[model samples]
Target: MKKSTLLIAALMTFGTVKADEGMWTLYNLPQAVYRQMQSEGFLLPYRDLYESKDAIKNAVVNFSGYCSGVVVSPDGLVFTNHHCGFEAIRSHSTVEHDYMLNGFFAKTLADELPNKDMFVSFMREQKDVTPQLESLGYSRCGKDQQAAMVDSLQRALTDSVRQIDPTLHVDIDPFYEGNRHYATVYQDFTDLRLVFTVPKSMGKFGGETDNWMWPRQTCDFSVFRIYADPKTNGPAAYSKDNVPYHPQHWARPSLEGYQVGSFAMTMGYPGSTSRYISSYGIVERRDAENTPRAQVRGVKQEVMRRYMRASEAVRIKYDSKFAQSANYWKNSIGMNKCIDSIGIIQQKRDYEARLRQWQDSTGFLKGQLSFPLLEKLYARRQERVRTMMYWRETFRRTNEFSTRAMQLATGMEVKGPKKNAAKKYHSFADNSNEWDAALDREVLSVLLKNYREHVDARYLPKFYTTIDTRFEGDYTRFVDYLYTRSLLMKKGAKLYYNTKAYKADPGVRFGQDVMDVFYDLNEGMGAINDSIETQERYLCAAKLRMEADLPHYSDANFTMRLSYGQVKEFELGGKPSGYYTTPESIVEKMNRAAHITDYEAEPIMKELLSARDFGRYTDKTTGQMHLCFLTNNDITGGNSGSPMFNGKGELIGLAFDGNWDSLSSDINFDARLARCIGVDIRFVLFMMDKWGHAHRLLREMGL
Candidate 1:
C-alpha cells in the first residue's frame, strides 16, 4: 500500500519525463481550477451564510450523479449512470422479472422503490486539517502506521460534530493527494429510491465492446430520487409517505449545441488515476506490467466468454465473475493503447521540454532540480524495480487463514483499557461480521497450498514458503492449529466473529495449545512490517515518493474522478484525427453487434448520412466534429457518470470515458489526448426528449 513509486534521474541530463505548466499542480488550486470554478458558479452556494456545517452540506448535496437524471420538479431528481445505480435497480429486480433487462418507471410517487445503504454525499465545508493532522509527527509514524493516526484523528473530529448535531455524518477526504485532508459532513439520507431507467438494450446501449470508447451512441442513464423523513430529519427507508428532496438548484437541458472550450465542472466521485508518477514507472507499467496483465486477463475473458456461449449452466455460474474480469481486461488494453500512442508519448516529451525550459529561466531551480535527477534515480533502481514487479506478479497470495490468524492474535491487544483501542477493536469486529468463519478457515488452507506452488524458488531463502518446509513439514498442521486456537478465543472473546466460533466449536480441546505457536508466527510477519530498518530503507522512501508525486497524480481507487475537455479535431499518426471513433464505440456495443440495424438509426450516423447536417460538425483542419474543452480539471475512472457543467452551472455533457491514446495520461498529464470525452448534455437531453419521448420530464425541468 505504498502510494508512491521511486524513479530517479541524474542531475544534469534531460529526463524522459517532466512536469510543466500544462501539468498544473493541485496545490496551486486557487490560481487555476478553483478560479474557474468560482467564475463558473461551481463554488458551493451559501458560502458565507452557514457555518462550517452549511459549506459541507452544500458540497455533499451538490455531488453529481453517476447515472442520468434531471430535476423533474423543483425537487431534486438527479439522473446518472444506470450501472451507477445498478445496486438500487437490482434491489427491485426479481428472477421472474429482471428490472435491468426490462427497465422500470415510476408511474406515480407510490411506485418508486427505496434502497437501503444508498446515500449521497453533499460537501459541507473545508478547513485546514494540516496542523491537527501534523500533530501526529511523521517521524513517529511510518507509512503503514499513519492509517491508525488518520483514523483516530477522523474519529475525534467527527465525534465533536455528532455530539452537537446527531443528524450530521462526517467523512474525511484527501485532496491534492495525501498532502491535504478535509472532513466532509453529510446529510446522509439513506432513503434513496429508484425512479426509472431504460431497458438494458437502451441503457447499456453498446455493451462492453463500446463501453469506454466514444463518438458514441447510447442512452447510458438512470433516474433516482432522495427521500427524507418529514419530522425527524433523519434518513428513512423508502415509503410511499416520504417526500422528494427539495434541492438548492436544478439543470436546464440544452440542444442548440455548444461550442468547444466551454467552462466545465465535473462533480462526482472520480476513481483514482496516477496522473503523477515517475516516467520510468510509466515505461515499466506500459511495456512490461500492464501489457502482460492484460494478456492474461484477455485470455481468461475469451475462454470464459466462449464457455458462457456454449454452456448455459457454465454461463450462469461465471457470468458475473466474467463481467468483473472484463473491466480489468478492457482497462488494461485501453492503458496499453494509451501508452503506445505516439500522440501521448509526444505530450510526455513536451512536458519534459517545458520543464527544462522553465528550469533554465527560473535560475533558482536550475541547479537545484533538473530532469536528469529523475532519470538517474530511475536508472539506479532498474533491477530492484524489476525484482519487485516479479514478486508482485508471482509471489503475492491472499491466504485467508493467515489474515484470520493475524486478526485473532491482534484481537487480544484490543482488550486493553484504553478507550480508543477498545473502540477501534469493536469497530473492526463489527466490520468483520460478514465473513463466514468456517469457509474462511477452509479458504486459508487452500490458499497456503496454492501459494507454495505458485511462488518462485528464488524467494524461498528470504522467509516462509521454502522448499524444505514443503518437503519436511505437515502444512495442514498450521491450518489445524489456527482453527483450534481460534476456538479458544471464542470462549470469552467479545468480538462477534470470535463469538460465532465459540458456538460452532465442538470443544474437543485437542491441539489447542498450538494456537499460541501460530500467534508467534503471525507476530513474525508483523515484525516484517514494523521493522525499523525496513521502515527507513524501503517504506519511508516509498512514502516520501508518494507525497512528492501526489499533487500531480489522480486517485485510481475505482472510485471516480471527472476529466473535463471539449471534443477537438486533431492530427495523429500522419492522419487527420477527426473525432476518432470505431464501430466498437457504442456504450451498448453488444447490442449494436446483435442488431446491426440499430447502428443505421444512430443520431451520429443519421447526421453522417445527412451530410448537410452532420458535415457542419466536421473540423476545419481534421474535418471532424470537435468535442473539445479547455480547463484545469483533474479526472479518473469513477468519474464516468459525472456531469460536465459549464460556467453557468448548466449540464453541458456526461463524462463517459477517456480516449485509448491517453491511458498513460493518468500517470502523466498528456493534454494532447487526455481530454475527458462526454456525451454532450445536449445529446443526453436529445435522447431523452427526442428519442425516448420523455417530454413530460423535460417540461417539468422548464426546458
Candidate 2:
C-alpha cells in the first residue's frame, strides 16, 4: 500500500472506529479490535467500585491487573478478585506444594505468608466536581473536536481525584465516546499473601488450552489476604507479625449460584476494544487477513510447543518463547473455533439479511456493490495466494529476528567498537545476570547464527538481493565478511584484529574511517528499500482488490470501546448448552478428554464431586444450576479478573469469556445469541471451602 493508504488504513482500524448499537452508541471503536478485546473481556467495568479518590491516584496498574483489590474486613483486609494472584499461585506451587495444580490454603494469618509476590492495591478516595463538565453546549463539533472536549473533561476529573487524595493513583477513562469520562482512583497496596486457592485441577482446571471455551469446566479462581501496620492503618508489608487488614466492606462469599438470566454487574478494569467498523472492514479481516495469518502462526506455535514439551533441550532453549507463544496459540485456537462456530455464522447471516433489507428500503448503499464483481476480485487474488502467504509469513518471522538483532547491534555500538565487540558481549551478561563470559560468548554466537538462518533472506531485500551494501556484494564476500568481522571472533583473535569495528560506534575510536564510509549509505539504503517495498506491495494489493471489489482492512489494534449485550445461551450442536459449564462438566471432560492425567488424581475435582451438601446455590432470578452465570455486562480482554456482582453488591462470578455467537458481538450485538460467561461465585466458594480448605479465609469474611 502507498504510505498514505497505509496511514489511512491504520487510522480507520486503530484511531477511528466506534461501536454503535442502534440508537445506543457503544463507542467509536473498530469492530475487529472490538471483538478481539471483547472476547478477551476487556470492557467489563464501565465504572468500577473504588472506595475513594485516593485509590485511583496512586494506582500504577495498567494492562495486566495492576492493583485493583477489595476490602474484605473492617481492618482493611484487602481482597483482589482472584486471577490477580494466578501467576503468584503458580510460582509458589511445586510437586510437593502444587499451589497451582493442587491448590493451597493458609489455615491462619501466619500460614498465608508462604505465597510470594501476591499483592492487593487500594485507592482511598476520588473527587470529580467540575463545573466545566456540568456545563453543556451545542454538539456541532466533529469527532476530533468532541474528543478534545472529553479529554479536557477527563483531565479535570483526574486533577480533582489527585488533589483530593494526593497519595492515591488516578486515571481518567473515556466511555461512550466523548459522552462521559470518569476519574478512576486506586489506593496502591502491594503487601499481599496467599490466603487460599483451589487445586490447579480446579483452579486452572482445563488450563489455557480450555480457557474461554464452553461446555467448559474450570474453576479459574484464587484468594489472597492483605496485611497492614496496626499503628498506621495504612499499607504495610506481609511480615509474619503484621495484623490482618481491617476493611470497611467485605463481600459475603456465598454458595448461591446464579440463574440462567440474572441481573448482575461486573466491577473491574476493562482493557480496550473497537466495535465501530464498516461491513467492508469485517469481510476483509475475516476472509483475507486474520484467518490466514492465524493459521500459519498457529501451526508454527503448535509445533514449537509440542517440541518444547517433548525435548528438554528445546524446552531450555525456548522457554521464553514458549511462554509468550502459548497465549497466542491458545487465542488462535479459540478465535478459530469462535469464527467457525455456527452461532457466529448465523449472526453474520442475520446481520447481512438485516442490512440487505435496509439497503433495499434506503438507497444508502444501492448498486454501489455487485456480487459478481466481488467474486471476480476473489478469483484474482486466488491466483497469487501462495505469493501473498509467503511474503506475509517471511515478513512476520524475519521481523521478530530483525528487531532483536537491531537492539543487540545498537547496544554493542553504544558499548564501543571493541576488539570482537567484547563490551557488547558483556551486555548480554548483564541481561542474563550470568557473569560467565564463556557462556555469554557462546550464546551470543548461537543467537547470531540462529538469526541468520531463521530470518528469511527476503527481509534483507536491500542488502541480500540488490548489490547495494559491500557486506552483501556477493555470497563469497558475505562469507568472508562474517569470518573477518568481530562478530565471529574473540578480542585477541587475529581475525578480530584485522576486521573494522562496527561503524558509527558513537563512543569508540577504533573504526572511525571504516564506519564513516558505510554508516549513512547502509542505513539510508535500508530505509529506502523498506519504504519502497511497503509502498509497492500496498499499491499492488489495492489495485487487485479494486478489481476484485474487495477492500482490505488491517488487523485489530487494541482500542477502548463498549460492546453491548445480555447473558443468554443459544442452541448449538443439538443441545441447550448454558453459557457456562461447571466443575461437573470439567470432571466429565477430564474423564473423557484428558490425554494422560487420571481423573482421580485431581483432588480438587474429586472433592467438588464428593461434596455432601453441595449447597443449593440459587441466583433467585433464573434458579438454574448457576455453574456459570451470564450477564449483559459489556467486556473485553482487560476485564478477565473482574468481579461479577449482583445488584445488592454480592460477588456473583468472575467474567471469563463470551459465547461463540458473540464473536461478532462487537460489530452488532445480538441479544438473542451473545452472552458473557463467568465462573459462578458459588463454585468458587465451594472450591474454597471443600478443596482449598481455606476456612480461615471464610471466617475472616464472616461467610
Candidate 3:
C-alpha cells in the first residue's frame, strides 16, 4: 500500500473512539465510528444521537454559549458544572447570605431564585450550507474582498431566515478552512432560575491545585430550571408569573453506574482547537505566545493571592477573574513542559516532511507555495507577536480596570450621535465597574515595570517612553499619578462629565496614547495574520485535495459536538491510574489550613468519606461510593458540564475537566494520555439525596 493510504487509515483510526481521542461532531457520525460504537457496547439506536426528535439531542443545551448542560426532567430542570454557573451563584451571594460557603437547596419550586441575563439555547436544526457560501467562488480573494462578500451573503440569508421566526438565531459557521459551511438554528430560552448547588468546599474541593488533574474528588455540578412565558411557551425576561418549561427530552440518571471498560459518549459544545495549524504556528505558540503569558499571569496571580488572603470580600470580588487567569496560566506552563517532553514540535516536523515528500511527487502540490509561505510568515511576524503577547498579558489581562477607564474616556470623546453616545458611555461604564481600583493599581504597577523590562523598546507602545521620561522609570509613582485624580477611578461619578475633562486627565491621555500606538502596531499585525489565514485556507484546500479519501472532522469552535469513548484506566510512571476515586482515598488528604486558597476537607464530609457510607446510589459491585471517574472523550473547556452517557444513553457522569497531560490537545491530541474527568452521577444523586436533602428536587427527576 502507498504511504499516503497508510496515513489516511491511521488518521481515521488514531484520534477516534477506538483510541479514545476524537472530538466527533453530531452532524454526522461516520459509518466506521457507528460500527465501532455498537461493538463497544452502545445499545441505543444510531440515529438517536443526532435526530431532532431524539431524547439525547433534545435534552442537551448550549449554556449561554459558554458551557453545556442537560435537562434531567420534563419540567426543564437543568444540570451543569458549578463553574459554568459560577457568576450567577456569586451574584446571588453576599456577606449576609454567603451562598458560596454554605450552598443552596430550593426545597420547593417557590424557593427557586430567578437569575438575570442567564440563558440556555437548544439547537433546532443543523444543515450543510457549503454550496450556498461557496457559490461566489472567491477562495483566492484577499481579506477585504472575502469579508465584504461573506458579510453581504450572511446578511441576506440571516434576514430571510429571521422573517420566518424573528426569535430564532441562525449562525452559519465555516468549516475545513471555508471549504464547507453549516447553519445551526437555535431556540434561546432566557429566565433561568437557580435550583440547587453544593457548597464551594465540596463542589470546588482542592481548588486550583486539583484543577485539570486526575484522581479527583470534585462534585462540580449545579442545578437550574428554565422558565417560559405561560401564554406563548417562548423565552421572556424574568417575571413572577412565568412557568417552568417542559422540554421535549430529558436524560435519565442511572444508579446502575459505569465501570472500567464501560462504553461512554460525551455530547456538548467544545471551544476552539488548532489541530490543522502549521509547524511554524506551533513553534510560535509554544515559545513566543505561551511563554510570556504564563510568566505574566504567574506574577499577576501572586499579587491577587496576596490581596485575596488579606480579605474575604476581596476574594469574593476577584474569584472569577483569578480563576480565568489561573486556568490558562497553568495550561501554558503545562503545554510548555509537555510540548518538549512529548516532542510535539518534532512530531509536526515529521508530519511536514511527509507532506513535502508527497508534494514532490505531485505536480499540483509542487506548484503551490502556500505551505512554505505559512512558515515564513509566522517567522517574520515573531517580534510583533511577542510584543502583542506582552501587551495583552500586561495591559489587557492584568490591567483590565484600566480598559474601563479607556472605554469611558473614548465614549466621552465621541463628537456625534449625542443621545445614543451618552447612553452607550453610561452603559459601558456601568458594566465595566466590576473591578477593584486598589487591586488594579497594584497590578498596573507591577505589570508596567515588568512590561517595560521584558518587552522590546522598538515593538512597545509609545506610552512606555513617555512614562520613562516623565516619571523617571518609577512605574509605581506613574500608576499613582494616573489613578489618584483620573475621573475613571472616581466611582459614582455620572458619565455626563465633559469630554475635555477626559482629555486633560493624565491616565486618560496615557490610555489614548497607548491605544494610538497599539492601533499602528495592530495594522502591521493585521496584515501578517491576513496573509497567514489566506495561506492557511489554501493549505487546507490543498491537503483535502491530497488526502481525498481521508475522513475529516472540523476543528471545535464552541459548537455542539459528540465524542465517543469508554471508561478506562491509564498508568503513569509504572503506577496504575484507576478509573474511579473512592471516598476513602479523598479523606486522607484532609487538611483545613495547609493551603489558604485550597478547599478544606470539612469534618462532616471527611467523616462520611472515612466511614465509607455507601448510600443507595453506591456502585453495587464495589459497594463503595464513586466520587469521580475518568474517560478519554476528547473534550475541551466548553465541555464542562456536558453529560457523559453510558452506552445505553443513561446519564452516568458530568464531564468537568480534562487531564493535565492533554493540554496539547488543542493543537495535537494525545491518544494515550488525554482523559476527561467527570463527576459520577451516582455520587451526585447520593449528595443531592443525603448531603443536600433535596428530595423534592429528586422527586421531580422521577426518582
Best by lDDT: 3
lDDT of 2 by residue, 68-112 (tens): 334444444444434556657655654455465456776766677
- Residues forming the 10-long window of minimal summed lDDT in candidate 2: 426-435
Give lDDT tens digits, candidate 1, residues 28-50.
Answer: 23233343334434444423223
Ranking, TM-score, top scorer first: 3, 1, 2
- CA lDDT, every model vs. true structure: 0.49, 0.46, 0.79
Candidate 3 Cα lDDT to native: 0.79
Shift of residue 190 alpha carbon in model 3, Å: 1.7
Each candidate structure's TM-score, on Cα atoms with residue i matched to residue i, is 0.63, 0.60, 0.93
What RMSD does each model have against the real structure? Answer: 10.3, 11.7, 2.9
Global CA lDDT computed for model 1: 0.49
Q: For model 1, what is the alpha-carbon lDDT of residue 463?
A: 22
Candidate ranking (lDDT, best to worst): 3, 1, 2
Residue 5 CA displacement from its true place in model 2, Å: 45
Best by TM-score: 3
**Candidate 1: worst-modelled 10 consecutive residues by lDDT:** 11-20
Candidate 2 Cα deviation (angstroms), residue 351: 9.4
